[model samples]
Target chain A: MRIVIIDDSGLRATVLEEGLRDAGYDDIHIVPPRGAFVARLERMAPDVVLMDLGSPSRDTLEEMLMVSRALARPIAMFVDHSDDAMIGAAIDAGVSAYVVDGLRKERVKPVLELAVRRFNAFAKMQTELDEARTALSERKIIDRAKSILMNQRSLSEQDAYALLRSSAMNQGKKIVDVAQALITASDLLGGGL
Target chain B: MSLRIAFLPLTDAAVLAVARERGFAEEEGLSLDLIRSTSWATLRDRLVYGQVHAAQMLAPLAVAVTLGLSQQPAALAAPYKLGVNGNMLVMASDFAAALDPDTGRRLSDPLGTAHDFAAAIGLWRRKPVIGVVHRFSSHSLMLRYWLASAGIDPDRDVVLRVLPPSLTVEAMRAGEIDGFIAGEPWGSAAVEEGLAETVAIGERIWQRGVEKVLAFRTPWLEENPDIVDRLLRALIRSASWCDDPANHDALAQLLSDPRYVDQPADLIARAMSGQIVVRQGEAPIASPDFLLFSREATPFPWRSQALWIYSQFVRWNMVEHGPEALAKAGAVFRPDIFRRALADADVPMPGANMKVEGALGLPLAVGSRKGGLTLGPDRFFDGRVFDPERMEDYLTNFVSPL
Candidate 1:
């Protein structure tokens, strides 16, 4: 797996790099401390990111948050210390693991593994949430279309539902998609249905 | 009570460090875990999210967080102030050359130096980029206030970059920023390394200016009043010890530990003792009262001081002025809590919760819970008085078309 290390301190970065290499991770990249960092990370496209913020300011923390939000890769952050607000922000920004005051060479592999595992678990849960939300919204749209049909055509709810299903099957689209199209047409045509 | 406190590695963190190291907390029946943070934002976050019981936080930052400028609005309370007036503004040697030639005079007279700085800005090669620790930091606000006095627009005339105080020297060395205003040892560190020269000291800008405070989430403070009281009492004793002349050397040594400021003993000593070396090869200048710990009830969390910080937020357009927000900002400084915590102690505190900020021009006797409290000069260099009661009027004095 490609790994990236983000640390402003050269000595700390070197130590982290050596530890990662010792752990048999050959593909490693170090992010430069300055310039367009997110763009650079996107181009590097590492599977895992190990960030060492020796002492981060609010601006640096915000920048790191943006990186975490943009990248889908599992990231582990090492800091001398952290506060609750920053940790909350890091978690919200999708940082998989945040290790504070335990950045020794011997501890690297397990932390990396945990970070990846946690990130994958979180990503899976996020995907499930997105799917559930999509389904719920689709059901809402389908119900709205059914009610519009029932109101305009003087049909029962079951007949309106059947009409939507038939229309979806004939058009080779999901029922929700067909319903959404019908709603859009009704609204665009001044609801003249 | 077992309390885990987060703090940045600066000299001002002495009270917390001493409390943990000197067994002050243990004496108060509390076990203390002091975590050294690198940034104010992280420390603020730590307190807000309940990762730590409390934190050594920037006074303005606490207000800003409550005002919802820095992060999600959290009602943070500062029942005690850790230290006052311990920061400095250091400019690159080349840039410093353009300012007043006489270093001693410039350092002594802030307003004259500010005028000199205004003139120097015109001759500079570029709009000088000055690094400030944080947007909501007292250093940045003071920098703005000092620069504005000479008709220099901080927003337009110069570039203010945000960098951690520890990284300030490297940024200046890399030519990324021309100068930086940060808390002690970092400024002293730059001077020691011959990377920068001290141009402005926070003590001279506004004597006894509020810097760091003991901050906690309001809910946490309210829930653990007994613990908070214990911590404050411990902190009060620690502050007195930290202020003792005999303890300065030991305090400097403690701060130099890798887990703390992690700098040379002498660099930390200079700021701690109020004898700062503005430039390399220069004798240390006596800047007494440079960093106050407990003298004159320095730990007392004055509510008016909080309003003064809010007024700056308004002056800088960081937040829109509203009575509700103003009340919230002022409420962040919990003198009531301080009074409750120190009620039994020998500590003399102001009788009133608020005072006319920047009004004191000399050491004056003030009405106190236990009289005989003499406050040091609390004057703004520009001679502007901030009446907390008349915040709108105070703000109007700084109204411009910015």
Candidate 2:
């Protein structure tokens, strides 16, 4: 019932570990992002390995555990042939698993499902963080564009905002898009805001 | 009208890129969304899980997938071959310097160099670790064949590390592996950066050796014949365009885009044009037929080729040898589907589905159903032929490395 999580991102691995811990699986090990991975995995002798699909070392793991039969016990990729939906969700969530051969599907299914849920949650949080960063950057761009409009046309902030909104509506674009266009044009005209 | 295909970033992905970028896919009323994947395993998962309609897969991998050697057993079908013979075997400069001084001769005579390699392995500081892209890859199988011929047991004499093609050069720089066999322009990139020297070309091991095949889930391909036909048509056009020397520059540029191979255009161009730089600051060697995308039915999925891969699997003990396993492996390459798709096209189609592999010593024009076709010079480096009908007899010739 030992579990090993192989991930380059410490944050994501910690998230998955916390989820697994809450599920009451106490025997858990986390392999660091890089280094002599095969030797470490051999030493750990994990009953099940949960790996990030994006890691390039997955191939190395495959060669050692699957092809070369370097491990004393055979390990097969955890595949629930009956649950295609779950498998698809796991792959989309960027998580993959390998388990010691002959491990029952029932024993591993909940663990895999939990990993998938945690991965999806982590991915959503990452998306939100990226969007928040983008929002901050775009807000700066819009402010710059507004100031350029206010300074060049000798208008107030309210007037510059209304002009940007009107231009966005007429051109069937977002206000941010129009603001970005204005900034680009202003930069081309050698004007600084 | 829309199809998503997953592919690893390599020069052999040129057909897929050309089909999408050159408007061939558009001309056939199809829209192709090419997903650049980081590894072969992920690409297989994407195709198996229905995230992608198809994938640019290693031919042996497609067979292995069907045979249930990797991951969940999915009936993956490869109806079209993306390209052939673009892989290079590169060893670190220090290790290669122990072999032949003439880089061109080293590649030209792989068997001689392989013996030299065996001799040099003892002279090395430690057991040389050779990086292969995947365990179920053609390059790995070829490396096994090339090394075993010199009595250098791949498993005993060397360590085979599996690294993605993109990471090979960096792996070399980090001193993690002594050499690697992978598709270009990763090999070219490594040689260009002066991290490694070319020891062998895949083409020299087996002329017109199978590389990447356009793979799809069997059920999807079976259920949607019309879409498959259209895709094959688009790929055929793209492959012809890719094979033309006149279009090498444009094709190289197209593949150099961030979304594709993402290497320098000049480096990518070498593989396509068959002009390779084996060593840093050395003159390029012209092999002329190094990589083939089309012409001589390079795009055709020959069933014999799949059986050849199966033979390697049995040789290496990767899969249990049995009638059921053999049938499953051979069926991975669908020549029937390929012929059905190209039935009405102006291009020539081979009359038979299988042939004696490595039997074609020189290019010979053969009778075809649609037009004139020539196939050949598909000789093995060891000069052995693989007859699909006599697989047992063919396999008896090899002494198992185990």
lDDT of 1 by residue, B1-402 (tens): 678898888899999989989999999999988887776656765676667888888899899889887755688999999999999999999889988877888888999998889889998998998988888889999999999988889988998877788878888878888999999889988888899999989999999899999999999899998999999999999999999999999999999999999999988998878998888889888999899999999999889999999999998888999999999999999999999999999899788999998888899998887857999999999899999989888888984634
Evaluate residue A185 in candidate 2 and report its C-alpha lDDT on the 0 to 100 scale. Answer: 92
In terms of docking quality, model 2 is medium
Global CA lDDT of candidate 2, please?
A: 0.91
Give candidate 2 regions above 4 Å deviation.
Answer: A67-72, A150-153, A185-189, B400-402
TM-score of each: 0.75, 0.94
* Residue B390 CA displacement from its true place in model 2, Å: 3.0
The 10-residue segment with the lowest total lDDT in model 2 chain B: B393-402
**Pairs with steric clashes in candidate 2:** none
**Regions of model 1 farther than 4 Å from truth:** A1-30, A35-58, A61-193, B399-402
Relative to the true structure, candidate 2 has a C-alpha RMSD (angstroms) of 2.2
Residue B346 in model 1: lDDT: 84
lDDT of 2 by residue, A84-164 (tens): 898788888888999998889999999999999999999999999999999999899899999999999998999999999
**CAPRI category for model 1:** incorrect
The per-candidate TM-score of the B chain, in the order shown, comes to 0.98, 0.99
Q: What does DockQ give for each predicted structure?
A: 0.18, 0.63
lDDT of 2 at B195: 94
